[model samples]
Target: MATSTAAARREEARLAYDAFLEECPTGQLLARISDKWVGLIVSALGQAEDRSLRYSDLGRKIPGVSQKMLTQTLRSLERDGLVTRTVTPTVPVRVDYRLTDLGSSLGGLLSSVKLWAESHFDEVSAHRDTFDRATATS
Candidate 1:
């Protein structure tokens, strides 16, 4: 009876997890972080000891990012409350972005994901190449 109850509870948990995934898909998160520029920006910001970066400096730090795309990504991150934007009063307005507490928590998660990708990317590529070769031969 105890074993049966435990099994039923496990089945209920699995169903809840599946329902949650269906309700809130990972596609949006993937769209936010999968972009080369976004990942670079997030990683760079995450690395900063202060966890903050000037708008102009950030643009220079991440090479190959267009002004438009960076602006868009920053706006999206700010809207999501993952990053905070501050405008400083100066001769010319100075703007900065810093990761919020929530965003800081995600840094470790992103780092792990990055490490996994680096470690396994070559193996995955090799597997794809082998599959392609086999298909060609067949």
Candidate 2:
């Protein structure tokens, strides 16, 4: 009886965090996960040789990301239970990152989005150019 009540309560709490509501916790999560850096870093880690890469390797793989920004995004992903950070004691101390199971699930979705953007950029750009020209004259 007590176990059943606990399970019911857990399910209720889970149902409360709706992403559709502006003030919901899931909405906050959407904002975090939707960051450009988050998507890129996740995709990079997911596509690595063994789904892991050293910190420096990640920075190199991701162009236009400053060291500080890379560090910050990795920290954020770590905090959110998406990526795992491992430290190895070496001459220079190596740090490696990999996506967790939860992150791997998200990785597939983000990678698809990245690929779609790559696939459709020319068409999207043409639409954007038309919009800009039309809006400029009106």
Highest lDDT: give the candidate number.
2
- Off-target runs (Cα >4 Å) in candidate 2 are 1-15
Alpha-carbon error at 77 in model 1, in Å?
A: 0.6
Q: Residue 29 error for model 1, in Å?
A: 4.6
The lDDT, on a scale of 0 to 1, for candidate 1 is 0.80
> Tens digit of lDDT per residue, candidate 1, span 1-138?
345688898986676556246554455665676777666777778987788999998999988888998999899888877789999999799998998887777666776777798899999999999999999999
State each model's CA lDDT, in order. 0.80, 0.95
* Runs off by more than 4 Å, candidate 1: 1-36
Whole-model lDDT, model 2:
0.95
TM-scores of the models, in the given order? 0.69, 0.88
Number of residue pairs clashing in candidate 2, backbone atoms closer than 3 angstroms, sequence gap of 3 or more or interchain:
0
